[model samples]
Target: MSDSEPRMIEILRILSQQEKPIGSKLIADELNEKGFNLGERAVRYHMQILDEKGYTERKGYSGRVITELGRDKLEKGLIYDQVDFIYSKFEEMIYLTDFNYITQRGNVVVNTSTIYNEESINILKSIIESGLSVSPYVNINEDKSKGKIEVTTLCGTTIDGILLNEGIPAQPQYGGLLRIEDYKPIRFEELISYKKTSLTPLDAFSSPNRTSVMDVVTSGDGLIPANFRLIPGIGREKTIEIIKKLDKIGIGGIIAISDEGKDILGITVPKGMVGISIVGGITPFRAIQEQGQEIDIKIAEEIRDFNTLSPITSTIKYGLKPVEHTPQPKISFLLSKSWNLIQQVNFDIEKRKGDIISNVSYLKKEDLDKTLGIMEETYNSNPKYINPYYKIVNHPSDDNMVGIATICSLSIDGLLINNGIMSNPKYGGLLELTEPPLFIELISYNGSTVDPHKIFIAKNMTSISGNFGPNKILASFKEIPYIAREYAVDLLDTLDKIGFSIYKIGKPREVTYNAKAENYNFGVVAGSGLNSIAAVRERGVDIHVKAIEQLMPFENMDRL
Candidate 1:
């Protein structure tokens, strides 16, 4: 049980005694008089915790009343119910103790709190965004810490009344939070340029599909087929399945930006949802009708058809409310003082990229494993990273495949990184990335190159490959160079920051100029030099800045 466990249970019992909804302030006064000596903060905390799970029935900004569940728990503990640990993080908790003494100064009595979850307590807030309710949890046979029962709500908990795949329940997953590096990131070229035909909407909607809303949205073509409100408690997979069906029927490619501005997709794909309402009629339950006034489905469909900012489904109710915002008060599960363990990556590597020749496994952390006993999900492996060498010039076969490992920067959401450090290999291998910007330097007299630097003091001249100004005489910034003077302007000027820098040498001499704009398709004048990009007639040049960024290791050389 949490340190506040006993007090919380006591608060719930008191609130349940109230016949009508009681204000947070009143609860504080009641607790105070009982010699229990709790503040309004504790009063509100108890109510919030209880109400979130349908235990207490919280009336709007008014007060709270004991709900059936609240009465049940108040009379008989929820001994057999299992809480679906839908949310994974614990650090983001915002603890607020019942402390309302200051509010009584003027008698209005505003309540204050004192909670001790993780700092920055990032509570994974979930609410009903909108849509029909479905099974929101996977219901495994796992039981977490029992020292303190973890009570949770599984009702119509949606993000903003807008349910995606029903509801993204708060189940913690082992190796979840995807360390980004796990999935293969296909480039625009790779994703689009494939020989595989673009699957038609019907073809893309596989019977056994497993993708996200956006994926289905992207594959869709015309308008949403139906407008309906979803009930809470549905799972995300079901929502995705619904989207897949819409895609099959043909949906307009999501307005990369527009939803409320279009027909049949108003306020869709919300960045953040407080709650959701739909225009259509209340989803007729299997056995009974719903409580709220039945909404106008025809109006909603019209709004959707007209592409109004308000989707038809939203006309169903007032803006949706948060799940935790519910009122009521009874709890048996205490979010234990400590959380059940999930998994961890313990690093054993020292900083510094010793030597490339030496076989060194860049990562120095032990591999993580499954924690199904604790967290609810599994982590997908296969970290992706960038391989700059794969795309180097003169290495035509290189693909410049991207590679990098993905890992979460957060520990437990409720617990926070209070006791650990988040580490990544790239940051750990900083020294190797900029070893003085690698390049080859030339010796003046010997004409031999060692250090990655150059002093281009051509005694004669130089010739550049690739095309020139319609075969026109090569002219300097001021005059044509018939007898080019050998001056080391910058040898590795061809390379950019990714490599060495350019330098000059001693004495002035003339040399045949034969330099080529290695990767410039936009046409090169004076400063234009070879780049990481190999000029070709295939695809035209890209954004100028991007081309240059690809080239590095600019060096300088001097001749004898």
Candidate 2:
């Protein structure tokens, strides 16, 4: 294949995206915009050759359109001639990325995945919330009649673009599956060098049978798609600084940076070069595929204004609402409302539980204020391990006393129940501090009228005071029907985004973090909502404690 054939192929690609015939001048302009240095005369020469070969046909004087053969050729052209095709496209997108970290403006390259169903959208959002994607921001387009949804996500090459804009000469090396254990990247499980492949390596590795991104999202142990890049040793510090800035603006995917002359994840680095591992942008779609959903993906498909993308949380909060001028199907509209109703019912159940607990247990206003302060301090000290939702209400009996409501582990049970999964509260226990943690003491929630966390706290069974010796924290155990594992994992991920401290969701009929499940049920371990109050009590504050407290609006809760 001649050099001009590649240019003609590009022209065919441009024509494929157009709905009508386009002239050579317009094709030349588009080519130039994409960094191809073709002029009208040169493009006309390519088009004449394309027509002679029957790959494209001239439609009267209007212009030319790609033939059926042209579309096939575009997809299945000579492999040897396109040796570094993906590499070149990667470079082009990097040059095109203009996202300014400081001003938070300009265009960024994005990858789009089109799926045929709505269920996959939720799975994609959960993956984004798990932080496996290049950025948390995403753009979604839904067409219910066609049963299609297009998800546009930030591509990892955008980092390369930013690095280039900052005068750092970074070279993409390979795309691979990065092994993660306990949520830390350990090594590259498989790698394909960019110079050796015409196809996008990450995309080739994105099959459901190949990648374990969903496992990583749920258990923090599995392989995730990632990329390797290298920069000059002198630019190490500057690269790190830029990455920090990107993180501040919610675009995070830089896994690790190697020291000068050092290799990353056992891959050799050339002398005077530094390696950087980045999470691949195709992760969410990879996760969608893992759940047995089919998707058509395009890598580095186009550039869009950064302002047009919204955080993935928005999609989770608001389901596929109709885009402007696009009518939402009646069934789709009903499904969206049903999802919202499920969330509302779950919250209402918890709120009712809290109201019941509040009726019997009331704290003096002074005590309530102090308890809130203590809970805030505990959360501030370690927000990751603590629950952040609470409610304070006027006492029904005494004006001087107030009602304080905190999230209960039973809320997890309620969430599972609302989603059509039967959940049984097994035990409330003292989880001994360890790598995976262990339940040292347990009380049966079915037999006990009082919440077990409250019982354990009153009996001085918990030692979660100063993070010293024999440390134990509050946790609860529940079991869900074994068949509900997949649905439950997705639900737990959604709950995780909304401030639920879910510790571990177990495999079928197995022990999760040392707590066994029933024969046909899977175990779930969650942080007790009363853990903070336990800390307050440990501090010797005079506080009335109620576990499984009724529901409070999550948005109304204050953060420390």
In order, the Cα lDDT scores of the candidates are 0.22, 0.72
For residues 1-560, what per-residue lDDT tens digits would candidate 2 score against the true structure?
A: 24575687789889998999999889999999877899999999889988998999999999999999888777645333343566787887888888899999999989998998878988887877766778879889998888898889998888999999999988998777777777767777666566634446675465446678888866777888888999999999999899989977878777778878866675677899998888888888888887888899787888889998988773221111111222222111111222333344344332423211111235677776677787787777666567877767777778888766666666667567766887777766677766667665554454332455665676556665574433678887788888888888888877776667788888875556656676888888888877777787787876677654344555455454
TM-score of each: 0.16, 0.53
Model 2: per-residue Cα lDDT at residue 536: 76
Model 2 worst lDDT window (10 residues): 317-326
For residue 201, model 2's alpha carbon misses the true position, in angstroms, by: 0.5
Tell how far residue 62 is off in model 1, in angstroms. Answer: 30
Off by over 4 Å in 1: 1-171, 174-215, 218-560
TM-score of predicted structure 2:
0.53
lDDT of 1: 0.22
